[model samples]
Target: MSLRTLSRNEVANHNTPEDCWCIIDHCAYDLTGFLDAHPGGCVVLAQSAGKDVTVDFFNLHRAEVLNKYRPQLIVGVLQGEKEEIIPTNLQDLSSVPYAEPLWLRARFCSPYYTQGHRKFQKAVRRFFAENVNPEAREKELDGTYISQKLLNKLAETNILAMRLGPGEHLYSRRLLGGVINGREFDYFHDLILTQEFSRSHTRGFQDGLMGGVCISLTAVKQWLRDDDLRERVMEEVLSGRKKMCLAISEAFAGSDVNGLRTIAQKTPDGQCYIVTGTKKWITNGMFSDYFVTACRTDKGISVLLIPRGHGVETKTIRTAYSTSAGTAYVEFSNVRVPMSHLLGEEDQGAKVIMSNFNHERFVMVCSTARWCIAVVEECLKWCNQRISFKKKLIEQPVLRQKLARMISLAESIQAWLESITLQMCKMDYEEQGKYLSGPIALLKAYSTTSATEVSSIATNIFGGRGLTETGMGRVIEMFNRTNKFDAILGGTEEILADLGVRQVMKVFPKSVL
Candidate 1:
């Protein structure tokens, strides 16, 4: 059915409290009923009545707000007008400068991204924009875990397996409608997926959505002694029938993995380990079915797969981001984990734990870099549109400099990230732990530091809206509040810097001055 067409005069004629109409992006909205329920209030709607409110509406409201209320509010299109330039679909990439990476921009070419990468990127972006973004926004605010329905969709599409990064794990699985063959997947594809997933822009909820499976399942796939046991665990978690988290941090230990006090004593019959420990700040723990946990044993600190069962308990731990992450304080009270659950050598679990860390931090870098650019894009849009003191924010010299700095930081970090990602593609896991750890560490440290700076500059650009939880500047506010998680979660900025330097020092040559 054709939508009714209204002329400027027709829209103007309804300009009253009882019959309010306004034009936004060449579309007429019958907001007569919505006025009372408008978040900004009826006065604002009444004032906007009978006018083309495209500028005013976009200045204060995000495109998403329009998407949410459009069905009920929209009554017709402005006669003889077209909205060809308006960007309404969240699934499409932004035209705003620096909104996307260089490779994704028109007329820009990269040696890294291939045809498959482009196709896969589009598919993944559409999937999140359509399937995940709605739920993430709701869950981020409500402090709920990822819904099973979404997880099932993700699993059915093999997205969960892809998040574990390219390997045998991806073998035989048709990924995202077979846009990319699993056998040919590489770290670049992994990078693409991680960045796309983070683009959901819901920080804590991003973590809540099967993030644990990404970090924990790799350890199970690599170090579990029994192949059957390992495959079983992987199938369960990746299929979304079961959930898992990496349990390494405790009250007494975080960066210092050796300081863990969690104890695991062997049973008399050698059937299981009686594990007793409390793991703090575990992502996705609140709803996890398996915990790839670190514990102290007869020999030394070791890693084990502790299933959630009798004597296992989880308590929520609220953090700077939403509790949607399921960050929890977990207690294992004499939990009986079978001998078959041991990962790697009993005492050499540090090796297994260390194996996952490089990739974990690499994933963190990918997320942080993408998120920084997303914020830069947000600031760019706001500066271009938001007027202050008789001019758009972009017209000011200081704000321009801030935008310049934000852009430089974001671009440099992404470049470094891509460099490291390519090296990861070339190296095996052991080789990566040996060669790329320091560079990745340095990259993550710099990435997070850049992110912090970007967020700070964005807040200044957005002013009061940067502090708001809704409206045009909400993206800026979200990044400001949660960008620090990158610096803290994988490893502290200071600790990573030190590690990066230490890695360099390991091969340093002695010199006489």
Candidate 2:
């Protein structure tokens, strides 16, 4: 990595296209050989020849781009100069103010987080940074499915199991090579994992990364009557042998669960059912091997575990985000499901379906809040790196006010998220269902709504770059486009806000007359 020091006067002599050189991040690059191969072509290089182009370079490219061409293009350092912006180390916590949650900062403390949580966070962050992030960016852009090889790595590391949160599944396992015992895993660990995945900022790939298994398998474990069936499915999914998705939302019904049109008919023999229904906007549906489905029965709505086979069809449905999410329109045409595969009871499926909502929304809140904060980080970085009107964006009083609000929003979201997570850690399923549901809903609603605000302000700050899909404002662009997914994914902000108020209303105090 060593390079010889060269003076600006020395570098100025190489101005010709035949021997082009430029300074970026205090390092002198020999762009002569790279000119023809540059993605932006020789024109920009010719314009930048023999000049210190650090600001121009970053304004047009991410730091990683320099790293990509470092060995070949970087020839020397500018004499007596050093870089202020170092290439990012994925394993390192960001130094940008409020880029990370308060608990993660050096001096700030949260009663909710512990040393075990810290250790687990570091290990998990490093693991994903090394194993998953490169492919995440690639798959997110190329709109391809996540690979089995990486899925297996997730399984092998117990990352897949951890994503399912604390359960018997994690009891006997070692997490991230035993950085923390599985028995010791708590909601904080789960929260950390969720936030780390979101921090990667590959929104579509986030869902494709076993998101199905996280939301669907819990129902199988909780409601399926046949112990062997539940165990088999869990093993398959946790091992990445079979993928699963919760297929409940239909074209006609989403948040309104009862309005679902999918129907399951009991056979005369009473041994099986013929499920006939179409599910729209099913995440990971295109690649799922098993679907934890919802269907109307003779009595009421029932949850069913239907495998992908004859009569089961999935067609990709493009959303605002990448197709890497495997979002699909699913049709279950007279698919036969064993009576034993019924989750909970035939008429009591609503209980099973609703039971998953609290936890599912909780996880979504974790992701949503972290995603918003990550956008704040990107904005903060942009404010520092991006120069406008002869000064950095951060120096503008009005822009700084916008940032103050952003940082405040980010901090508030994380604080609320951690508070809810702490409550979750202390509460069991029934307790959470009774006491925490309303607050969690409110939090999810608030987080997504706040994200909406953050994304807009960020775009305005980035101006034209924020609208561009690639380059300096790509993160802002991606966030601006996909922030609505969180608002809609768990439940729309309106639905959740209503649910939150309604839940509290159930116990509202009667006015004194």
The segments of candidate 1 whose C-alpha lies over 4 angstroms from its true place after superposition are 1-10, 25-28, 67-85, 511-513
Candidate 1, residues 1-513: lDDT per residue as tens digits?
368988989998988989999999999999999988987789999998888899888778767688788888888998889974354577788888999999999889988889989898899999998899989999999999898999999999999999999898888999988888999899989999999989988999999988898899988988998889898888898898999999999999998988999999999999999999899999999999999999999888889999999999999999989999999999999999999999999889888988788889999999999999899898888888888888899899999999999999999998988988889988998999999889888999999999998988888888898999887777889999999988988789999999999999998878831
Measured by TM-score, the strongest candidate is: 2
Candidate 2 lDDT tens digits, 1-513: 678999998888889899999988888889998889987789989988899898898766778888988898888988888877677788999888888888898888888878988998899899988889979999999999999999999999989998878877888987888899988899999899999998778899999998988899988888999999889888888888889999999999898998989999999999999999899999999999999999999878999999999999999999999999999999999999999999998889989988798889888988878877888888888888787888888899999999999888878888898898889899988898889889999999999889999999999988998998888788899999998998998788999899889998899878842
Query: Which is the leading candidate under lDDT?
Result: 1
Residue 511 of model 1 has an lDDT of: 83
Residue 495 in model 1: lDDT: 91
* Candidate 2 C-alpha error for residue 97, in Å: 0.6
- State the TM-score for model 2: 0.97
Q: TM-scores of all models?
A: 0.95, 0.97
